[model samples]
Target chain A: MTTVPVRPPLVRSSDRIVAGVCAGLAEHLGWPVRMVRIGMAVASLAGGAGLVFYGWLWIMVPTADESAKRNARRPASPIAPAVSIAPSASMPPKHAAAVDPPLWTGAYSPGYPPGAVSTPPGGSAPAAGPGGYTPAAGPVPSVPYDAGAPSQPQEPSAVPSTGAWFRVRNMRYGKEILLGAGLLLVAAILIARLLGVEVPLGTLIPAAAILGGAAIAWMQLDETRRAGLVDKTKADQAGGWARLAAGLALVVAGVLVMVSGSGSWEQTWLALLASVAVLGGVALVLLPWGLKFWRDLETERAGRVRETERAEIAAHLHDSVLQTLALIQRRAANEHDVVRLARAQERELRGWLFRDPARDAGQLSDRIKAAAAEVEDGLGNAVDVVSVGDTAMTDRHEALVQASREAMLNASRHGGGPVSVYLEVSDGGAEVFVKDRGSGFELHAVPEDRMGVRESIIGRMKRHGGTAEINSSPDGTEVRLKLPAAAEDNGEGKS
Target chain B: MSTPALDGTAGDRGRTVRVVIVDDHAIFRSGLKTDLDPRIEVVGEAGTVERAIEVIGRTRPEVVLLDVHLPGGLGGGGREVIAGSAALRGTTKFLALSVSDAAEDVVAVIRAGARGYVTKTISGAEITDAVYRVAGGDAVFSPRLAGFVLDAFGTAPADIADDELDKLSARELEVMRLIARGYSYKEVAKELFISIKTVETHVSAVLRKLQLSSRHELTKWAAERRLL
Candidate 1:
């Protein structure tokens, strides 16, 4: 089994079919999400049921869960140092972590080649350590974790291999197309049945094949050409806006086929043919762009998740990991103990870093209860989450849950005493309240230490386009977050 | 995917520097171990604050390359490293490694008692150099960061007048003292219970109010004032 880089579930933007697997894959492989979607659509069209099979594969592919990840050992493949040029001190770390723009998006940073290393100009090299490092004199075998290379003596600075983008393959596109085409066939069959059209699998099979092929072929050819008929480097040089425009055009073509009307037996076949042509064309012309767009969306979402995870990881490190390491680093004269502590921190760090960022999007009541449990864990205080109005909440209810959790954390961390949390839905909106019996203060004078308050409650609420109100005094504080029923309104605004 | 574990560094007699890398990304850690020479070795890597500590006890790498944000904790969470018993003090060096050169993160890690601050963008070579420098009983600050440290400590001349310096809060003055002592921004934040942003604000305030242009000026003034 090919060992996929273990990552959190949500950050796996390449997974789009079931909770954004395609999006997760696109982000992971650094491809466009729209292209993945389009390609999958085309593939399903071409391969018929094969598309469905691909979707199944997506669902079955084991996503590395946090618990399993906590125990897995990361590959220590020795990486051969490439070069010894001085790294510029001014270059920010964020810039370093960001993928090479040209490789992923086709846009080039000013003065740099589309896929060149982003080294700053005239940076000073760091002072050499003890032995005054010897450079590589001969050919060095490229290994992922080879530290032994530097032990040999040579001449100039060893090549410092840094960020490298993984190449996205056409097979993935085929996989996506097949998956997409399968979905369309199923939907079409279901629609036909819903309309009370009597048809056997044998009869529908031929028609499905003909229509799916036509759709996949047409979309691929037309859209691929419109996608500028070039690869990533050349395409990115064209600009993101242009790529998006081209992708939209292909999507339009695909939509046209899905909706086009031609009812007669012969015309029905013709419509199927037309559908194939349009979808195939769309897939080819704009799928890459679409895939890229989708990937970016997923990436952004994952980035947020990653940020939160990082924050949580940071908290863990501050609270426990670093403290333990400090002890080992300072007073652990026993090499074994120090090594053990260091290893522990490393495990925790890897847990936070390598673990997936996706939250299990399950039932609403369960999720709320889970949120309550998590709050209790965080604050060491009991939390009660209640549901009002029988209608169930979906993952969409997370904003409300997060708001309540934040409020609870605030009450526990700074409200000066224990707290109670309540939730209810009324008047086309849902309300969550966190009430604490502890001493509170003026709302205007936000406590500097109250980061989680501003970030979790306020930030989450604002993102979901909701409102949070805080009422506090020396006696106690009550925090409430309200979400309008039309939360979907803001969902469409994301694009 | 179990690859062969390190052959338990055969009979290593002397102590090794325990280290942890904190960053939100894995690709950043890809070439880390190879970057540091024999003087420093990476025992583990972490993506968050909490896990970093957990692993710290397990692997016991002497230094941690701490990132500001991780999966389960805050960026400034590394304070536990500093506030811990002296047993942990000399054995580990929490060298904050992050994409955020954000003054807040820098000061925060410094106040957390991280021995050094270096951004992710630093070449594997510089990172290697940093590990060794920090290991050898010296505090390491990137040249650009040197100024922030000086400013945080308010190492300006007392003769510069109390009125001009009044713009700096008493907390800011405390930050200045720590900075002058060679603490990173992250360390400063942990020390002050302020965000890295607040720490930066203090540093900037001192720089602006005292009319001192660089860390060198602050250092000189502090030397004259006997602050260090």
Candidate 2:
């Protein structure tokens, strides 16, 4: 779906360090401003690309509120300027803010809802964060199911995907082919005996000699070519199930021929068919499973390799970012807002560091922690999150995290005291309970404009293959969000 | 805002509790200095592990607020500070104040003789109470961190067979650690001063033993086990 014409986040006139670009980006994207600036600064390392990019973003991208006014008047000026930027200098700074002075050091992240799928190759990488580590988003092989198709028309981005597939399809197995041929020859000999052909048994001697010569020829192929003979799902293995059934039928026919035809006409024809069927059945049933086992081994090996990569990333994050953030927290001065930002940033960094790539959110406990921190950062309050049971990583984790965050926000706004979050994970699924001691409001009392309770909380759970159970009274309010084990297909959230 | 830095006989018990805050960050130290319970006196503070040892030695505070990561002398972390101040172990207590609740950090500090390890999230009152408890020779840890300690050093550790680690070479272990932390394959290669090709080989071997599907699953597995 084509979203509304994109506009730059507004510069927080009150919180600008240098034109509030970083602040705007951070606020707009729910990312740490410092990281955004750092990311911009890092992007600059590409031979002043960062500076030039930041400059264009400054002049072109309108502020958030102003964009609303502009959108009302007309559609955005057809998505970005044609010659978006000069190769170097000689760029005009148009449509000045009129209030704030032009500052060289700022860029705002585009405004997107929290947990939205980040459309990249545009936004400052720092602003695109769950674990805040997309800066390292190098090439990833596309999924096997869609390896043949890519949505983007121009770019040929399926090289690695095709490469993996090619390796699998091209593989061959010589030993199986040779064995099949040998089995067929044995069946042929049995059939010939039953047929009572004019040729004697000595005629088969030359056939054996020819088979040995073919085996010798097979040994001449190179090691790689020879190894190809071990293929699992090649042409030789196709009608295995059919062959099994036919072999049983043929065996019955051969025995019948031996019994009935012996007393009447020629029994050799019946014996030949029966013996051949038995051979086909036994080979089809046993050999295919061998191929299946081999294929499983290949996938398992690949899985192990991926696991190692993830573990390495986690370890590096532990030593580098996690530790560094801790030290910074202890050392940095208590600039109230800065300290709060640091705490929030620390939690986000942790989340980003440990997140599962499959889901925007990682473990259940992690989602709870992130939601709690986000709530605390947005609304100044203490959220104590207690997790119970081993957390399972599931695709629905991001949706669940989103719902929990909204519930926490609702609690902090209406609830009277500290928010207590309890996350319970079990075999069936996970349940997050956000409880606050504040005076509760009736569910029906919520106004139409407010989307927190209705859409964010309840709607999110339903789309995520789960449910949100909210209970409130004068005593307090508790939002128990339930998630099913087999989560539904994602990305169906409605406004 | 109204009270002096110290009030006469601030504690109900009529005695002042002395403290030394050791952390690399100046702001956190200053904040701690102001927010500390009135009865607790901030005698001295240092940022590096070496200075922390010296400050704690000179101040001989009853309780030392230690951060896990510092600047000097053998990585200058809290565990180092605790080990350096072994001479004052019986008289002085070390309460680790850190942002990390990672099992590794917690267990390392606690194993190195920290009286307690509380995360920075705790409020001043809770920290003060923890300090007092540690001063009285009691051990303390964050609820989550305590679990890490138990899992790492508790009775279950032996059954888990730390020896399974023997199967991995030191290099492989290093590779596993970097991958587990969520580093990109290329980044791991750069950090370890090895070729990306070598990293891939090592990764294959590590995954083979771990029996995991991919880096994503590996990250989750490491997190669940608290190895990360």
Best DockQ among the predictions, by candidate number? 2
Q: Per-residue lDDT for A1-495 in model 1, tens only?
A: 111111122233333456565675454444567876786778778757537845664565445353236324432111111132112233221221221222222222222232221121111111111111344312223331133223321211222212111111131234554675688878987899899996676545545545555554565555656765244466554555464555554454444433443234665566667877987998899989999999997798678878988898688778887688679768668865664455445434544444334433354545555666666655555443433332356444776676776677777777643355544455577666666657786766878677777777777787777888887756567787877778776673121
lDDT for residue B224 in candidate 1, whole number 0-100: 36
RMSD of each: 31.6, 28.3
Candidate 2 wrong stretches, greater than 4 Å = A1-340, A348-403, A416-420, A437-495, B1-15, B87-90, B121-123, B136-228
**Proportion of native contacts found in each model?**
0.00, 0.00
Error of 2 at B107 (Å): 2.5
What TM-score would candidate 2 get against the native?
Answer: 0.38
Give one digit per residue, the lDDT tens place, for model 2 in A1-495. 122112333433236665656676665454677887898899899999878867865674556566557545642232232112111111111211100111111222233343222222112211211221232322222231133222222232233223322332233224544565688878887888789855444534444544454434334334336555354465434444344445445445445544453344455565566767987899899898989998997898678778989999889778767776776677677565555556566666765554446543355676577678878888866565656454655557778888888888888888845676766566677777777767888888889888889999998888777889887777567788998665544544322
Model 1 spans > 4 angstroms off: A1-495, B1-16, B74-87, B150-155, B159-228
TM-scores vs. true structure, each candidate = 0.23, 0.38
lDDT value, residue A342 of candidate 1? 54
TM-score of candidate 1 relative to the true fold:
0.23
Q: DockQ scores for all the models shown?
A: 0.01, 0.02
